[model samples]
Target chain A: SQTIHQWPATLVQPVGSPLSLECTVEGTSNPNLYWYRQAAGRGLQLLFYSVGIGQISSEVPQNLSASRPQDRQFILSSKKLLLSDSGFYLCAARGGPTGTYNEQFFGPGTRLTVL
Target chain B: AQSVTQLDSHVSVSEGTPVLLRCNYSSSYSPSLFWYVQHPNKGLQLLLKYTSAATLVKGINGFEAEFKKSETSFHLTKPSAHMSDAAEYFCVVSDLWGKLQFGAGTQVVVTP
Candidate 1:
């Protein structure tokens, strides 16, 4: 099992402000981490995922970017936010061990409301 | 390429009644499917998964999903609906290459 911690349960930002959301994982080593955004009426969309430290793969092309500075940390950032960025962002870590390998454990999520 | 479609955007059920959530998926090969539930303002939780195993997959909290390859369907069902069961459910498909494609969520409302 992987325990994920996300920061700033809620955020409100202006259209041009910079953005940063952090997710940290514990209880596993070299685990897979993912960032997803959930919009109203739509399901969660994979934004980026990291397999290891300093290795990030972007799933969707957008102004947003992701970084894995540490093995236990995944950060999502944007140089300039857009109104469309308003949504619920989630951080998930894939389950470890043999039986739970395919499952993912999620964080409480961060709700961003860009004005 | 893989994609998932949840048939309903919303479903309402009475307590102690049955709950059904329909899902259809498309993939190039035999894919891995999963069901996840999300409570209000909370994160998504894995309810169950089907990875080329038994056609009938039993999940957490008395939830189950039937994988019917002939129909390309993996429908989730629960015999008794609890108030806690009211949440947003997602149907997801995995390509085994680190990508989990998700479907539009279905919001379940349970009434007393």
Candidate 2:
């Protein structure tokens, strides 16, 4: 019965602007959090992942950064956004090991259009 | 390193017909494989997964995939396709640390 929620389902930002996307999971504790981005008609690219609060791993170097401020709250931020930063950003979560391999559950996603 | 390959970039099928989406993968160890579906501008949804327990795995929305070790293939299929099945499907492989590697994705187009 766990669910993931993302804010600002859609956003239009001008170039060189700041970016902030939030993700939170309810009904779960100490879950693994991930941030992924998908370009138009392309697959997902892992941007960052967190195992616990204040612990974040970057999968690829880019204009974005992630922070886990709470056990179930993750945020993706950028001081200045680039045109290339425009894409569909997704947040996913998986429960901690419970004697079985956990499958990731995804949030609705945030669509950012940079103009 | 673990990787996944979705054979077709796009597949077109008629309504009420069989649905087949091919996927192959490579992994250094016994890997966990998954199938996810993405509606337009939506997030990916887990369809099914293979964790070395069952060769054939059934997923939501009447979709199933069979894992072939020799071929390293996990192909998804459905007995009858519906218009609602038109979407993009991805083949995913999990690494040692449980991070997912996604395929380029296959866009399934259902024709009336």
Candidate 3:
């Protein structure tokens, strides 16, 4: 069985502060990782996705960016956070052999409140 | 282009009543559809998926969805509503590159 872990289940950051959120998957290698954000009373928005290490694709342009430092480790970072950056950040992973129907598995998520 | 539409933004149903959350999709090619549930302040959970093999797909917690290519619809249903079922549901469509396009989401409110 594979498990995904995210750090700082809840975070409170000041405006203009730096942000870092980490996600890691155990029991799987070379998985597809994704970063998503959900505002209050809204659906999810895909921020970034990575098919492999050092490869990241941005779905939407914003203050946030994602990086895949290692095969199973993904990080979401921002040099300076904005008030609009406050939301529930989620990490998801999908197993890959390159051509298969893979359903994404989500982590518990991190709630970031900017004040 | 691929897109998904969840018909109702919010749905209220009484306990013991049937549940229906409608969804329609548009895709250039044969698409993969999925339904995910999200509790308050929680991550989304996979409810069911239509991968072209089965027209009718059964998922966890007594939930099921049927895929209708003719109508371009994938609607989710349950025999009876439970209070535990109160949550937000999202309709998702996968494009050729496996990118998921999410709907605005439907909030299901099960009343006792």
Candidate 4:
């Protein structure tokens, strides 16, 4: 069975501080990775997605960026965080292009509170 | 472009009663649809999916949904509600490549 791990489960960061959230998947290879953010009581907003290592696509322009350093290792980072960046950040993965598999498995999200 | 609309922002139901949550969607092509559940502060868990093969899909936790093409609706239903079912549910539509578009979630409240 495949599983995803993310950390720190919760974080409190000061405004304008650097931020880093890491995600990794086990028991799968060459999986597509995605980053999403959900504001309080709001729907998920796609941040970034990667097809392979060193390949990333940004869905929304923001202070946050995502990088796939390895096939199953994805990282979300920001040089300087903004107050608007405070939200529940989620990492998701799906089996690579094998056909019409559209289901995405999500990781335990990181709750970032920028104060 | 694909989109999902959860008609009710919140739904309240009594325990052991039937539960229904409404969802509507718009897609340019034959799309894939899904319903996901999220416990408070937890990650989303996929409940069910429709990929044009079956109009009625059964999911985990005794939840089921019917895909109506003419009405453009996929409404989730449960025969008996449980207290544990109190959570937020999201209706999502996606393409074959996993580019998902989610609806503003509907919060389900189970009353004792």
Best by lDDT: 4
lDDT of 4 by residue, B23-66 (tens): 99999987789999999999999999999988999999999999
B44 Cα displacement, candidate 4 (Å): 0.5
In model 2 chain B, the worst 10-residue window by lDDT is: B92-101
Model 1, range B15-48, lDDT digits (tens) per residue?
9999999999998888889999999999988999
Better of 2 and 4 by TM-score: 4
Q: Candidate 2: where are CA atoms >4 Å away? A: A98-100
**Clash counts for all predictions:** 0, 0, 0, 0
Give the per-residue lDDT digits (tens) of candidate 3, residues B10-99. 999999999999999999988889999999978889999988898999999999999999999999999999999999999999764567
Compute DockQ for each candidate against the true complex. Answer: 0.53, 0.58, 0.65, 0.72
State the lDDT at A35 in candidate 3.
95
Candidate 2 positional error at A62, Å: 0.9
Estimate candidate 2's RMSD in Å.
1.2
Scored by TM-score, the top model is 4
For candidate 4, give the docking quality class from DockQ. Answer: medium
True contacts kept of 2: 0.51
Candidate 3 local lDDT, residue B57: 99
The TM-scores of all predictions, comma-separated, are 0.94, 0.97, 0.97, 0.98
The residue-by-residue lDDT of candidate 4 on A1-115, one tens digit each, is: 5689999999999999999999999978999899999999899999999989999999999998889988999999999999999999999998858467568999989999999
